[model samples]
Target: MIERWSRDQVLALAPDAASQKAAAGVSAPAKWLVTGVTGAVVWGECKGSGAKPYRACVDLSEPAYKCSCPSRKFPCKHALGLLLLWSADGAPPVEEPVDWVGEWLDQRRERAARQEAREKAKAEAEPTEKAEKVTDERRARQRAERVEAGLADLERWLRDQIAHGIADARRTGLRDWDELAKRLIDAQAPGVSSAVAGLSRVLRHEDWPARLLAEYGLIHLLAVGYRRSAELPADLAETIRSRVGFSTPKEAVLARPPVRDHWQVVATRDEERDRLVSRRVWLHGRATGRPALVLSFAPVGQVLDASLVLGTTLDADLAFYPGAAPLRALVAERHAPATPIQAPPHGIRVAEVPGLIADVLARDPWTESWPLILTDVVPARSGDAWHLTDHHPKEENAVPLLPSAAPPWNLAAVSGGHPVTVAAEWTPDGLRLLTTWDEYGRVVTL
Candidate 1:
């Protein structure tokens, strides 16, 4: 008989459980219990060292298999082999989940509920507090002082650049921006640094006069904002002043309780303009199932935190940056690393692609190179339409596909009625695909 599923595929679906083990040889068989979609649970145990022994309690209600193993690779090979065996037999074992498994399940539900309640309370309380006038005033004063200092430094630097000649700056290449940006950061003026970095871009582009004017205008604005801070409205004054050169300590910003969630580090990107550098880390919360964006900034030659790896999970407590629209963050207990998470599935209706492609008429439609995994592929042919069917049925939901004029890669047809399109590049870990959508109303990459 043909096997219903492969060993690797079944193992891939298992949740990570490395954090629960004790060091040294296992006196008894290690155990694991997994619940399947149909409310059935599988309990199993593992033994042996070089050649492992695995025993599982199979549940027929929903196909579930459990195994005991010490490998950090989730279900390991034993569980997958068991599931494969069960699938081929076409009959599930009749066994109930043990007390320990039931208890863990119960606790998970309770924790989820508590987290929801806390979030609700926080949301309700956010707008009720007084405007914090004293703190605002102090912050305003500090911002003003920093901006003044930064503008003075920037003015001096600009004069030096002019004296040395614009050609000298051009000869220095991209490194010049990095040096200036770092100086601005050191002078407590991230905003000015950002503005200065813009000049670098303008310098490279055609029609340099307007770009130069705009860059000078921005610098002039920073100078004016610093000079007129006392005369402006409190909020605008604060914004302008801060943008010029002020910085708040990270500790101060992270003082409040941050948003807590099991966050999945989805993607990371880095960019440098002038001397300033920025690292963007995108997170998706598993509990709330919401996406959060976090940013880290560094001056030239400085290194940022390397804790946030792609696909890993982190149970983080994050604080939002203080602003009108602040990003959520991790505050304390940042070390409680979670298991690696898989990207959600992205699929399309059987008939969506043909029309989408024909309408856009691009040889390649994906903009960003996100990996596209199609679970369900079905072939279809209409009077004037032919398309492939695909679906992403993960818990976090599939990323939407985008319509693009041309994508950089090709789409491969999978066994199911689906066509899988992946980015041209491949990493040792796996395929890294951009999750976006196309004009034909599909998520291609983001």
Candidate 2:
């Protein structure tokens, strides 16, 4: 299939030729190694590179190209040549040059095996640990003592925030939250830290009062839960205990039954602030079919898994991370091959701005800006305000835009004489428009 397609078209679809080649090379070998779900598949391939050895990986999920030879086209010629071999009916086998490809495949197999073994060991250990009771009263007393200290620190931090006032609290920002969270971590009250961090986000929003009240209520709940853990039901007590910084081994979470299904990636959003890049992967389970949100955060520039695509479905076995609130998951398999994302159901009309806004708010009430793409744009005046109207009313959908300090409105033109609206306020970096039609957003640089 790939061979029949024009090279330009393939390269256009995948800009990183080298990466494509690497990905193709991985697929060339008959040996299929099932890597963990986030769409990881590894195979082996032999390529003839006259003088030098050739080995590469073509990651379809990321469409990434990695080759040992220094070819700039992402995956390079080796990858492309290898993929070409696989796609053919009866591909000719090139003479074996070296053990480079074999070694690479061996490493991938070893890594996969080690990971599987680790998961199996963890699963086996969960029941054993849970079955054992904390018979030592002294250990329990020490744990209680540590928790009390953490709570004391948290309460003091809250009082300080109140004394400083909301304005001052805003200025303190995430650093304040992080510092307090670390303190709680030290004191062993991690649940309090999580609550405080969530509150910090609310503080950044335009409406602080409602957010503050909700946060305060959460704090109160945490306090109450912590105090009553001894009397509460086992699960509830465990939940409270975990939230409050009680550590559970990874094996424990794996011990629980896995949530297996074809999970559709509904939305993928990332936020980078204060050296932390947080990626949220939202999946709708197709079997139990429940909506589950996973979160992964990395320090600046470190990429989290990029294989998940919004609107693409994967038959995966996901394992949640171990923590108080384990919202992070690891992918197990890519059941069905990826297809193009389907457009959003609810349409955005150029004429009905308010309706569009309302619809966007319904889906994301916290959104500060709504994204719109206009097939045909005409300047329309509503009283003293001027707005761009979309000509093909049903063609576009509203997208959420984060709040910014300035004009909060932005517009850009697409290739088909269509103009897209991005909340001007979302960082001067430009609008993060969600469009299946275009890879890049219609950026209107101020």
Candidate 3:
């Protein structure tokens, strides 16, 4: 059955306002013919400039879109419009997709299988491929040199802002932010470019000055980390370089030794970029109590890797990216299929959270988010703020929860004025709940 997507979810998939605006015009029933959903797919036909109507189809399972239109845009407007129609509350319930839909689905599967086979073959050939590449190494070194020079410029600019004071920097306007971000991109430091763009969100807060200071601290820390990278351990050095916008070839990372465990998929967060849909899936070792993260990317109109699902356990081998505090990992092998788990694994206490934060920060000062599980905590509201308070009287400590927590009413209701276990992201920004478990041990993805 096709999982119904919400309008917000559909809008989030759009690359730009133009695509969304165009989709909005074609959302009504009158604009489509033979519109229906069957299995994991939604299909429809829309009148087009061409003599034949354009066929629009979407796979809801993987949630990929396919439109028989010549538009270079990945989903194009027709596919967006079709999804909007399907996501609409008044959408006509559909069953049994047309014959064309079935054929298209089959072809998609075949192409995906072929792509996977080719990727596997390439992975096998990488060691030899890498060894034969002196030219590639030289180019990579040149790129690194360029990035180092960019970082030096960035550090100087950041110091000038500090010398002038953050208030002056804020007063200077958004153009400063935009211009610096552009410079990073031009210098091939794309990771820091995005990070620079993200600072705008921090500046919008009521306490913008403090947030600005923190942001400055993070940037300065990254610059220093990059400069002194070689002095750091291999993994930590890799992490610092990677955070500074250096690309580590995926094949090389996958070739590293794998960490074998019955990995439990805790929760995931997905963000869309131009070429890839980046997803970060957190995992916990059932027996080892270790935490690792898997970063996967889905090409536009392709499914994210389906092997990891929340609240499931899998026997797998994870190859972690080199870092002092290794969290980002890749699945190198799967020994068994994932099985639904009845309860969340045992969690550390709220009191222990700070020490864990300190430990990871000691390793990578730029660490933004860290995974944490709390066994007994209650959601408490004090005025306008939400907090997670330790339910245990002896070990009680109240921690401020992020303001953006998914509607707190349900979480409060689930608490029933009592304690519950939760999986969350521990960050400098504050606790952002990801999943929770009732006293009965049933898991709920927030």
- In what order do the candidates fall by TM-score, top score first? 3, 2, 1
Misplaced by over 4 Å in model 3 are 1-132, 273-276, 299-301
Predictions in order: lDDT: 0.51, 0.53, 0.83
> Model 1: runs farther than 4 Å from truth?
1-146, 149-190, 216-242, 270-279, 285-304, 334-337, 342-407, 410-446
Question: Could you list the CA RMSD of all candidates, in the order they appear?
Answer: 25.4, 21.6, 24.7
Whole-model alpha-carbon lDDT for candidate 2: 0.53
Clashes of 1: 44
Quote the lDDT for 369 in model 1: 26
lDDT of 2 by residue, 1-446 (tens): 12233444344544464556554554444422211111232223344445544545444444444566665654465555444443442233334423554564467669879999999999999777665544445677887888887786666666676676667556666787788778777766766777677667676567776678657655756666677668866755665676676766557655665677877665567889789998866665655634456667799978787787765677767776543323446664456676543432223344555564565444322333333333334333344444444555565433233223232233332324354332122211123333322325322232
Best by lDDT: 3
Cand. 2 TM to true fold: 0.42
Better of 1 and 3 by lDDT: 3
Cα deviation of 365 in candidate 1 (Å)?
31
Clashes of 3: 2
lDDT of 3 by residue, 1-446 (tens): 55678888898888899999999998888888668777677789998887898998888877788888988887899999999998884355566677888899889999999999999999988987887797789888988888888889999999888787777656664788889989988888887888888888876689988888888888888888888887877877888787888776779889888889898888888889888898888898988889998887889788987668888889999887777788888888899888887686778877888887898898888788999878778888788888888897776587778876655777787889887888888877679888887667677777
